[model samples]
Target: MTSTLILGGRRSGKSARAQALASTFAEVTLIATATASDGEMAERITRHQADRPAHWHTVESPLYLASALQQADAAGCCLLVDCLTLWQTNLLLAEDETLLARETDALLAILPRLQAEVILVSNEVGWSIVPESALARRFADEVGRLHQRLAAACQRVELVVAGLPLTMKNETGTR
Candidate 1:
């Protein structure tokens, strides 16, 4: 079956919902896109790691997410990418934007061929006001565009608000 996309604002319960959905699968693999570059980020990553079930396998990939997905697919594992926003941040900061674009394209192209269930979680950044700084604005735009593309790629799409989920694109076995 094809994967699903869960989009929501920060702390809007998107990750929680994704985790719940992932639990249905026999083998769950978490693809972590966050990198610990600073103390705050490290703490955040720690908290996220603590929140997840101990049995779920975790793979840290701040870049080359498409390759990680392929690995998960090869293992016949259900995959949950907790947040795309952080991955976007990592890409934007990278010196090579071309690599980011290539990786994203590869990810989109490979998703349909994969056998495992996949759940992609991303922030709804377009709902907020325009960012003040140029870098922030660019990051927002990139993330928003990525979210749009992934949402279309998925078989099911859901928007979470106030910890409640509203299905945007409903599909069988998604409830």
Candidate 2:
């Protein structure tokens, strides 16, 4: 099994790229880590749902991502995680101090050992100035740390900018 991490900023086409790659596999299960707490977010989720193929299965696990991954992963199947940023946000907003760390650790431990091809999408949020709010700062710090750990665990790491993918790391040194 191969694992890939796709990192990009807002509107950088990270989701499209991950979906396109997953289309190559025989079967795909999208592990959506988003919750529509508001109308705008609900619209976004709907749009994403419309963009996917009818045959592709979707699993929504806003706070229980590791469990979803564990259940969906299988040989010859591909698991596409839309965005880790949203998952992190969900964990942070939960107000539970230990949830984020525990889930992050569980994900890191599970990724490298999965039997299916994994495509994880995350936002690159640390390029701009530091945020004034404590919550914003914590979010950036946590996402950065998560990205680093995921990159190390993934076989391929790609950075997307303006809808273009730039390969940062590849275990086989090709593709």
Candidate 3:
């Protein structure tokens, strides 16, 4: 299956780009990695859900992303994973110390074998200044390393900024 990784800063149109790319497919499954832990977050999730096409199937995968992807994959269908950073945050805060590496490894292992077209959205956090807190620093570092590995595994990689997309890597070598 063809796969692409879309990276961008906050509100940089990464999710929009992923949606546009997946629009070509006949069937779409949006695997969301967000949980409404607070009132503000609940509002944000509601807004995001309202923005997406109602016809698209939605799967809530706050932690076990790989398993969700596996269950949702279909031939000729498109699977869009909106934002991995949230997923990272969920893993980071989990009580199970081994959960992070286990889930991440599962995701990487399954990406190459999926039948559906894959479009992944992730925040580009490497550009910002280092965080003061150790947890924040670890989060940044983990996200950066995850992006690198995902980029290498994916067939195409694009960076979005100001609602514009720039292809960073394309195995097809075409514009």
Tell me how far the alpha carbon of residue 70 in candidate 3 is from the true structure, in angstroms, after superposition. Answer: 0.6
lDDT of 3 by residue, 77-150 (tens): 99999879999999999999999999999999999999999999999998989999999999999999999999
Best candidate, lDDT-wise?
3
Q: Which of candidates 1 and 3 reaches a greater TM-score?
A: 3
Q: Estimate each model's TM-score.
A: 0.94, 0.97, 0.97
Please list the residue runs of candidate 3 whose C-alpha ends up more than 4 Å from where it truly belongs after superposition. Answer: none
lDDT (Cα, tens digit) per residue for candidate 2, span 57-173: 999998888889999989999999988999999999887889999999999988877899999999999999999999999999999999999999899999999999999999956
In model 1, pairs of residues that clash are none
How displaced is residue 153 in candidate 3, in Å?
0.3
- Candidate 2: stretches off by over 4 Å: none
Worst 10 residues of 3 by lDDT: 166-175
- Count of residue pairs whose backbone atoms collide, per candidate: 0, 0, 0
Superposing all C-alpha atoms, what RMSD in Å does each candidate have to the true structure?
A: 1.5, 0.9, 0.9
lDDT of 2: 0.94
Please state the error at residue 109 of candidate 2 in Å: 0.7
